[model samples]
Target: MQFVKERQDAPAGFFEVEAAGLRWLAVPGGVPAVQPLDVSPTRIVLPRLTLARPTPEAAEQFGRRLAITHAAGAEYFGQPPAGWTDDGYIGNARLPHPRQPIESWAAFYAKYRLEPYVREAYDAGVFDDSARQLFDRVCGRLADDAPEPPSRLHGDLWSGNVLWTVDGAHLIDPAAHGGHRETDLAMLSLFGLPHLDRVLAAYDEVLPLADGWEGRVGLHQLHPLLVHVVLFGGSYVGRAVGVAARYG
Candidate 1:
């Protein structure tokens, strides 16, 4: 059996871009990604997966596999997945994909990830001057860290996008791109994941994260929160500000 996801009013290449992301994230021996059996302008067809209760064992394996996926690396920050030539989407919002690879993750993130949505949120009345200031502070501070090559990110790794099945956790609905690996891990923690500690521990065992990574969780989380503010204005405004305040 298969499942079909359709959006009659989807933007041009919407489902196609998602299909590309899934294909790009498919690494050898990595955590399984939901296979797109077919894709078109308006819809994507995927294999049906049986949902199961989460388990610590499955979570641990997923962590190790995820580490491998990240290790695949990318040409540079903000580079779109292979086979895609233009921008991507995140929950119906446009996600920028630079044709030219950027070696500096900080520059790419500030320009492509944070700033655009910040402007959107501000225009939508979900962001105030104070919030914008906080984000500006965070952006300035982002360069404090040592640089690392971009990881092949499952850009939206929140728990809801991680489908636990009888086989294990299978990734779905990716905003995949070249980004900081911590962003994915932070996103996993954003909305809570089953056996999250085990997941982190196993991932660390395979590929240790940078020191002070725990402290930067809020930094990586800020983008998604801002996107929330843009897409759903309300408590998300306060939530984004709260996280930005920690780093700013």
Candidate 2:
């Protein structure tokens, strides 16, 4: 495949490369700023790396570092030239139409982040009336006073997204945005991968979670669960309904 690289002066040695119809770039130093870019036609291929279960201490330390990085807030890298979707769903609602400003995290999540997915699921019959009602309740609660300030987010984070390289652990395949830091941590917890205690301990060391974080886990998870409900049907419907129940 033909690959073109555009150079940038960032510390990580960033570059924008195009192959096929998709556009992706590499951040030279180990850490991946966003999920490895996977345009459409050309796919991103990386070397094989070993991933072992991190020790409690190592996991905690790594988790702390991730928290610090997430706290770095968002970047306005100009407007996207086009729109795309994941699997079959749109990447995110188009920005700057009626409500795309980054005024507050809660508003962003409510409109652009969670609501779109919720509406999709509702339209697809993935969510029953009760489930939809509960979801609205949780969103309202979160909107009241979100736990943390808007921080840069790795939209879709899971164990698979964390690459353990020779240099250190790196995050890849990010659906990057500016939202809550806990959203990432909540994702780590939701999937049951990545050592839980260690990850939280590490995050606390760097940026301690606010009180009542435990209660908000359901709120943060609703978005992902809704996505799953849309993508995987019955399997996620129960889980999504359960989470919605918490706020209702």
Candidate 3:
């Protein structure tokens, strides 16, 4: 059988963290996770999945299982998996997953997740003074926010990472950690996941989301957008600014 292998020549413990994420997610049977066959500093090998078209049923199944997986819970906001230090990666971007002294999910996100990326973009000149100010407002208000318990998140759940096949939706290439469950759902909506409505519908049936969760999509999306701003270039800066503007 053919296998899929990911090779990365950067970071201190890149592949290891991903492999731990896959195992952590798979333990909850969240969705069909890529089989972690063999892992090494430079490579991770997994059994390749056959590609197929997506269906509502597949999407719904994915959603339901995703909720179950999330219900497994996490140690704390921004907590890393056991054995791995508080460090992670999102599409090659270094993510230092530090649990903030604050308690609220919004506070944790604002401090550890959003603020870091925004500051990075600012230092790199991707975010000008005006844009940085707007984003800072979002962070300030985060202390006033309340959210559900920290969930086992597929930290970067963008469309490219969710694969649809005959089996259902299988998640791959994750930056998994403890985070707000809505963050994953928000990411599923970001860049458009196929049958996303169906996915959310099924997920809601399994574990209902808080009211006005839809409105918070932009808020949860800020981190990834800023990540892109730092990782890529100017194109994502405007997108990040746009999302921050809405929250501000």
Candidate 4:
């Protein structure tokens, strides 16, 4: 494999690995193997693979494959390694290392994941008292149910994180962990990207999303938006507030 591009923004000591084990439903068997060799704290080497902007059909297939990957499931929530970050960002809400069993998704997300960030931001003055109260209400509603199944997630998935290669699509730089699959999909849509419609269509064809899945997108995105707000500052605060308002 040869070095192609370098990423400056990734957390320290991060690198992509070969796409294996997890079977992507859209691609039938799996994605073509590629090596993600670490070059430095913020760089990795990827073998050159020709890629073009995806067409609608291709995007849909990508979505379907993602759903299948999620369908593969996890033994328990929070199984993947915690995300690495500089400056103690603590992106995943300081959840218990090596995730333990939890009765419901709501409880897990509430205690181990969402609440911590809310509290941290509140304590730091990132959010006003009213915003904090609204967040609390949203968490309360989340406690009513667990996700249908625990999924092996690419915790920090986004449009740029997806690499469309000649052989197949690739997911890189994952904060890979077990959590709600929607979190991954939610991130994809967070920053508008091409081929999204196709991806969503394919995903729904395979997994058939629940009736109110659209409503939950805001909730799923809350974590990342909050992270961005905390890391980058007030620019993301409005977006975070918008998501919170939807849930409130």
Candidate 5:
């Protein structure tokens, strides 16, 4: 069986980049990615996946495997996936995937992740001047923070992207790139996941998270919230502002 996704009006390179992202995120002995069969500008064909209720055991295994996937490690922040050499998309928004490495995660994130969507939301009138200033303050704090090496990230790891099956979780619809691993984890938390506590615990056991990582969850969450504010304005504005206020 095959799953075919078609979007005739998709932006240029949409399905092509999605296929590239899935291929890039495929790591041996790691959580499985839904295999792409064929791709074109407007459509992608993938192996069919069956949905199942998530189990705690599967969640734990997914965590450990996800740690291995991140361990595959990218050369630098904002690096595009191996096959594709251009920016990608997250949901409906363009995601920055730069060729040049930015060694500083903070700088790369501030520039590529936060600033673009923030400015877009501000221009859309979803964000007021105060909200913009709050994100600015957060960026300043990031500048001073110690940086970690870039990880091969799933980039858009929201729970909906994880398809549970009899075998376990298979990742689909990635915005994969070289980025801070915490961003992926934070995204998982953005929308609730099944057995989330077990997932985080198992991941920590495989690769211990940084100290104060709990405190920094909101910081990592800012990007997605900002994206949401741009993509779907409404209560998302307040949600993004509240999270930014914590770090700002």
Candidate 6:
């Protein structure tokens, strides 16, 4: 790998929060994260990784590593990284993170993740009028969701973020925060990942997922889907509505 520098002009803490998340997530001894060579308010330097084809062996290792990463836990469900104090970002979008303390995971997720972005999507013409009511029903019944401690989430765990190299699977471009571990796994399953079954298998062997986890897949998926509908504006809106209807 060679040294690569990325430069962008933006608000002060954009890259800072990103670097903070990288440092925070990397602390738990598990998955390989991109080595943050150097960081600044407006720029970051990292080892530019060479991509390789994914294999089950590496996928299983990555799954086990990911479990260890999540097991490190976090202070609270909606907690941001130590230095970054705001809701983080996914792609170019602003993600609302929690500053106010909420007791249960369901309350934090409902208040911050589901309702806010759904409102944004609806306001942006992505969702139809009745969509909010369906989400309201889901939010109302979050207590029915399986209980678990906050998992250190790589908030944007889509396939594009997971890179396979000769060394191992490395996670990149994280919107790192404290949220439900199921949310991270849900994002992994959202877009197809190579050798993903191997990954899930290794994950299950390490830290067993909660009961009824499969049943709640769509529920955990609601946040990212809602984000995409807001960002992309098409069939995703319909899919988001469909997921909300399940809980409704």
Tens digit per residue, CA lDDT, model 3, 80-131: 8656775889988988787443577776888789888888888988778998
Q: Which parts of model 5 have CA positions greater than 4 angstroms off?
A: 144-146
**What does candidate 4's lDDT look like per residue over 1-248, in tens digits?**
37555557755433422122112212333323245543555555656557776667667667767887777676666554333212122332333323357777777777756677778788888888998898899888884333478876767678776777644477654555567887788899999767787788878888887777787888889888777766665878778988889887
**What pairs collide in candidate 1?**
none
Q: Could you give candidate 6's per-residue lDDT for residues 1-248 as a string of tens digits?
A: 65544556656567777777888888566887786777886677778888888988999999999999999889998889777887678776777787866698999889888998888987877777798778888999888357888888888899999989987899888888998898888899999899888999999999998888998889889989988888897888889888889888
Each prediction's whole-model lDDT (CA): 0.90, 0.57, 0.84, 0.65, 0.90, 0.84
Per-candidate TM-score against the hidden true structure: 0.97, 0.73, 0.95, 0.78, 0.97, 0.94
> What's the distance in Å from true for residue 98, model 4?
5.1
What is the overall TM-score of model 4 with all chains considered together? 0.78
Off by over 4 Å in 4: 4-34, 38-45, 81-98, 144-146
Cα lDDT of model 5 by residue, 1-248, tens digit:
99999999999889998999899889997889987999999899999988999999999999999999999999999888888888999999999876787758888888999999989988888888999888888888786254678899998999999999999999999998998899899999999899999999999999889887888888889888888899999999999988888888
lDDT of 2 by residue, 27-138 (tens): 2321344333333232444334555556666676567677766565543211121232111112222221122345566666676656777777889877777777777876
Ten residues in sequence with the least summed lDDT for candidate 4: 17-26
- Collision count of model 4: 6
The segments of candidate 2 whose C-alpha lies over 4 angstroms from its true place after superposition are: 1-40, 75-99, 144-147, 165-167
TM-score, candidate 6, is: 0.94
- Write down the lDDT that model 6 would get: 0.84
Residue pairs that clash (backbone atoms under 3 angstroms), model 6: 87-97
